[model samples]
Target: MKIHNSRLISALFAIAFGAMQTVSAAAETVRSLDDLAFLEGHWRGGEDFVFEETWNGAEGGVMTGMARGVSSGELKVLEYIVVSAEEDAVVMRFKHFRRDFSTWEDGGPIILMLTDAKENDVTFSADPPSETVKSIRYFKTGENTLQADIVLVEDGEEGGFTLVFDRAD
Candidate 1:
């Protein structure tokens, strides 16, 4: 009976330690658009295709931006983006459109909440969690370079792509 009690106590301690670790590992939510100031300015990059993004300075608790992807001198995609400070957290909402201005999403813009923030980097995840795009991250690699990562889930599999942009002339 004593040996059984000792084993049970050990298991309980392990569980408790794990719970504490999880809480510590969780990322803190960012509350201000100022934390993402590194993303400001015009950037352009791509391999076979060229893409450009321009971000305006934050004003009135909000920031606005747009991106255009071009291939062979033809516009392939256009994106409108807005980042705003909410009551509890900063949120980013964006929509994709074709050259003709047809929206990609059917219902509304995709909304992501600021989940993790660090110096020169920030990440946003779908608030309600979507089956499509899971998270978006932007980080500065150098004084003139920024990288954007988009993580997505499809058919029970997860994949992502990274776009590296450099300050445009």
Candidate 2:
């Protein structure tokens, strides 16, 4: 009788542990930009996509920010217009809002698949193709020069143009 009781308790404990692990793994599977350590830095770039920006040739801007996790960490992308020295300060720089097939993309809410980060590059990809590139590569050219290229296609054009962001210091 003692042996049987011990075996039954052991089985129950094992089942409970399995359930706990399932929940933990599920949480990890859904990735947010805040989970990316490489994205922790401050990055400034331009938005020059003709289809997405009316002032595409002018000065478009991009800003990514992260915050501490409460229930879950949150990451947000802000798009605004960087006015020239002779313009107003209320210019918007970010996109991902409209749906005229010529606006910014909706926030890429996805779970990260893999993080193949390196000393000079950090690749981030998501599930179901929410963002342009599954993985964003940050390649360093010099002390103050880096290039980030991501491909964006509207309405499923495989040979679409690449949204290139160049950093000039």
lDDT of 1: 0.89
| lDDT tens per residue, model 1, 1-169 | 9999999999999999999888766534335888889888999999789989999989998999999999988989999999999887888989999988999888889899988888899999996677678899999999899999999888968898999999995
Question: Which ten-residue region of model 1 has the weakest summed lDDT?
Answer: 22-31
lDDT of 2 by residue, 68-122 (tens): 1112222222233222212212111224322233434455333333344455554
User: How many angstroms is residue 147 displaced in model 2 relative to the true structure, after the best TM-score fit?
Assistant: 3.2
- TM-score for candidate 1, residues paired by index: 0.80
Give all TM-scores, in the order shown: 0.80, 0.38
Which segments of model 2 are wrong by more than 4 Å?
23-127, 130-144, 160-167
State model 2's lDDT: 0.39
Superposition error at 105 for model 2 (Å) = 7.1
Clashes of each: 0, 11
